[model samples]
Target: MRVSVDTDRCCSSGQCVAAVPEVFDQDEDEGLVLLLDAEPPVQRQASVRLAAGICPGRAITIHEE
Candidate 1:
């Protein structure tokens, strides 16, 4: 799976980071979403999907490429 995010739509809520620290993080100043790993390890798949689902703005997008 591949992960993508629209920065303009992100609110930096940190939900993604909280759910999947291995795949997501926040910027220091803007507190925006940042992908710590574009393609996270398999063990983190469920959390990554959960993060995408919990994003308030629907900014996170995932692809099975």
Candidate 2:
């Protein structure tokens, strides 16, 4: 699974970070979504997907390969 975040569309809600801190974070200064792991392990896929789905700005994207 691959995860990507569009910072431009982020609202700094931190939902992604809250959902999966292992794969996502929020910039302290900019308050934008940060992609910690572009390619997270399979074990983290469910959390990643949840984060993406709950993102208020719809800034998260996921790809499975």
Candidate 3:
């Protein structure tokens, strides 16, 4: 799966980072959601989806390949 984040829409809740640190992170300077892995491994797909769903700002998006 491919993951994306919209910093413009991000509320910096850090929920995505908490759900899947392997695929998401919070920027140190702005505390915005960061896409650590645009394309994460299969083992991390489920958590990636979870992170997208739990994102308060709905900034996380997933495209399955």
TM-score of each prediction: 0.93, 0.95, 0.93
Q: Model 3: number of clashes?
A: 0
- The 10 consecutive residues of candidate 3 with the worst lDDT sum are 16-25
Best by lDDT: 2
- Candidate 2 vs candidate 3: the TM-score winner is 2
lDDT for each residue of candidate 2 in 1-65, tens digit (9 for 90 to 100): 88778888999999999999999888999999889899999899998999999999999999888
Candidates 1 and 2: which is better by lDDT?
2
Model 3: CA > 4 A from native: none
- Write the residue-wise lDDT of candidate 1 on 1-65 in tens digits: 99988888999899998999888889999999988888877898888999999999888898987
Q: Count the backbone clashes (under 3 Å) in each candidate.
A: 0, 0, 0
Which whole-number lDDT from 0 to 100 does residue 31 have in model 3? Answer: 96
Q: What is candidate 3's lDDT per residue for 1-65, written digit by digit as tens?
A: 77788999999999888888877888999999978889999898988888888888889888887
Off by over 4 Å in 1: none
Global lDDT of each candidate:
0.89, 0.91, 0.87
